[model samples]
Target chain A: MRNTIGEVAKKFNLNISTLRYYDKEGLIPNLEKNESGIRIFDEEAVSALIAIECLKKSGMSIKDIKTFIDWCQEGDETLKERLEMFLARREALQSQIKELESTLNYIEYKVEYYTKAVTDGTEKMVKETMSNPRLLNLQ
Target chain B: MRNTIGEVAKKFNLNISTLRYYDKEGLIPNLEKNESGIRIFDEEAVSALIAIECLKKSGMSIKDIKTFIDWCQEGDETLKERLEMFLARREALQSQIKELESTLNYIEYKVEYYTKAVTDGTEKMVKETMSNPRLLNLQ
Candidate 1:
């Protein structure tokens, strides 16, 4: 099925401008156009866009995504390279998850300390409770 | 020990411009100036900057970090609100992690499918594999 830009935008819950930007960025390849010069995207293009969105959220840059797509279109010769890219990204994502988990832990600790300080109603206790070498270094 | 912006930037492997930008953004609230009005950041400021870097990587925006700092300076009354904010961010980060995980799964599936197609060397199999229902919806 072919979809107009507006229809796709509504369906995907994306802005028209973002769709246009992606098209210009070569993130969406070979879009079909009507006689009036409007973009008419088919199901293949939509699928590719979905894949692009997935890669984007995984922190793959547009250039890297374009390279991946090129490899996809090129077939067997690039399969190993493509697999390596996926594995690398998976590792990166794992690291990011770990980092975020650590940050969450720090935030939780702060929240608990602050909560205690507020309930206890003593500035000295609050200072003592909140004061930490770690807190001093936090942004 | 006080450090020049250049020294601090090099120490942190950050651009000097980033320090200036952070100063302008009020991410570092207590930065001192030297005799020539040059920025002179103390150890405490460096620690704060490190924390800011951590928060930034965890997807906190400069404005949100500033709000957090404001709460920090406001004392006990803001503790509950601050804790709520951190909790909300934790939830958001969890959702973001889930989204990334889903994307990673999708990428892994694609990579595996492509690997199999490349190994089989059958155009028919490749075509059939590419016609996944997930890809269909995206189109």
Candidate 2:
């Protein structure tokens, strides 16, 4: 099943401009083109796009993603550097998860405080209970 | 000791313009000023700024943060609405954390793939071991 760039973009709910931009940015290198200059997304090209989505969601910048693509194109010699990059980004993502988990804890406090306030038809209980973090520590 | 906006901004490694923007946005509603109009941030004001930092880092928008602040100032009457807002954002944060965690998993796979590739001095080894997702499931 051959897929055109427009077809792949539609399937992924991505804008055509975004796919074109990714192609220009080297995130989609080795993209095949027909004699008529139509973009062709083979299985390998689709896999690359999926990898790009994973990296982008994990907060990698366009420049960094391009570096990764360059490494892939350059082949076996860059494996060590690629491993180092993955390990570094793994730590960054871990820290991000920790930060968001803590924010969840904070938001839990607000939810509890407001729930109590709504129950009493006033915020007095919430204010009185404010100093105690454990009151909202549902976990 | 009383602190100026610049001092507080420097403490947090934030730009002076950011603090001014927060003030203009009403995130710091009761900021005091000296006789000559130099903004003086007391301990309480500093705490407010810290709270703002927490919310901002958790992906809250300027408009939403302003709504939260307005709720605080509007007293007990806004408790229910505040509760709804907190619940909505709590769900949003939960989704964000889930997304990040999945990204971490994807990165873990990459790290494992590259680690083996580097050890074998070839990308062929990386490609062979790609089938079992559980092999790199560090979590």
Candidate 3:
């Protein structure tokens, strides 16, 4: 059985318009349309949609996603290329994770600083004595 | 001495237009202007800019950032609010980091699968035997 675009969007927590736009952009390879021109999302289409969402969340641009999808359609001839792409994606995600960790550390420092200030009814003493130099330099 | 907006933008790796827009939106509290109305970024203004970038990176909306900056200008009266805001940001960053880690794992699985496929020069056997249920389920 196949799902309609609306059913798939609801299941995936994605906007109906976004799915339509993705179809319009030809981002979903081999996506089907019924006689009435409504989308018929099969298992393969759903799999492509999931990969699109994952790649997007990993910061791949729409244009790059199109290239990646095209490569997928080319079969094992592009296996090496796909491997290199995933390795690049891995590097990008690692840097992003590191950046978020640093930001989290900064926020944690602020939380501690504010906790003390809220208790003391003033931040003068806390500001004078407490400092996270790495966080301080980041800002 | 104060820095020009251009100098500050280059130092922070931010766009000059973005800085001007932030100033226009009053997102940077106490940002100074010279006799000709050009921005004069003082140490405090630079500090505010850094916080703005950090909060933006943490996924805070510009509207929410403006409110946070306003709270900062309100002195110790907003201490509790600032603490709560940072706590919320901490939670957000933690979740984002976790999501990226999950995506990274999925990509690493794909990398290994593709590497083996490239070595065999065909994915038939490898695709049949090697499966990552989590990655497959994600798609």
Candidate 4:
């Protein structure tokens, strides 16, 4: 049995308005309408919704995702294009992950810097430690 | 000898306007001025600029960073508050890194899914493979 848009949205923990927005944006590829003009969500529509959420969380814009959905609807002829899209997105995510890793390192440095300052009763202690010629010569 | 704003900007590969904006925003706690009223950047000023860039990249806002500089300039009395601010920001950066890592996993899954679609000449093939009763039973 198929579910109404409201039921599907509740099951997915998303707002009903979000489902309507997705349908309006053409992101919901297989939105089936009933005799009374209410939207019905089938297994295919549920799958599409899940895929859309996944792609969006991975930083794909809604416009790009719509293009990907269109390519999917076009069948085997668009397989190469779909693959290229994923490749580009994967590469971009890798770059972002690397940048975040560096940012994490900087944050860790701040954590240590502050932890010592807290222990020593003043940040000046940390600064003095860094600048002490005696400590530098010992190192 | 001190460096001009232009020299410092070029040294850090930042736009001259960014350094000016940082000074105007109180991010540079030690912007020295020469007799000609031209901004002069000494070693300490350069260090503060570097620290500002580091904190900004860690996602601190200019206004909040100005607060941090104000605390630093207030000497030992504000050490606890400054330390707490860095600790809070460090915790925030860790959370952001974790979220990005989860997003990276989703992107990796898409990469694999699309790679198979490319290999099989159609995304329908991947869907069929995923739903096969034999595969389901094995899993």
Best TM-score among the predictions, by candidate number? 3
lDDT of 4: 0.76
Residue-level lDDT of model 3, residues B46-126, one tens digit each, is: 778778888988999999999999998899999999999999999999999999998888888878888889999988878
The regions of model 1 sitting more than 4 angstroms off are A121-126, A130-139, B121-139
Best-to-worst ranking by DockQ: 3, 2, 1, 4
DockQ of 3: 0.76
Residue A129 C-alpha lDDT in model 1? 48
Best by lDDT: 3
Q: How many Å off is the CA of A125 in candidate 2? A: 3.2
Model 1 chain B, poorest ten-residue lDDT window? B130-139
Candidate 2 local Cα displacement, residue A60, angstroms: 1.0
Q: In candidate 3, which residue pairs get closer than 3 Å at backbone N, Cα or C atoms, i.e. clash?
A: none
In candidate 2, what are the lDDT values of residues B33-137, reduced to their tens digit? 989989999976776776676677679898888998888889888887888888888889989998888888888888988878888999896697676463232
**Residue A17 lDDT, candidate 2, scale 0-100:** 93
* Model 4 spans with C-alpha error above 4 angstroms: A1-26, A30-49, A131-139, B10-13, B35-37, B131-139
Best of the candidates, DockQ: 3
The predicted structure with the larger lDDT, 3 or 4, is 3
lDDT of 4 by residue, B1-139 (tens): 4899888888778899998888898888767887888998987787777667667777899899899899988987887887788788878777766766666666666677778888887777687665322211111
Q: Assess each prediction's global lDDT (C-alpha) against the native.
A: 0.77, 0.82, 0.87, 0.76
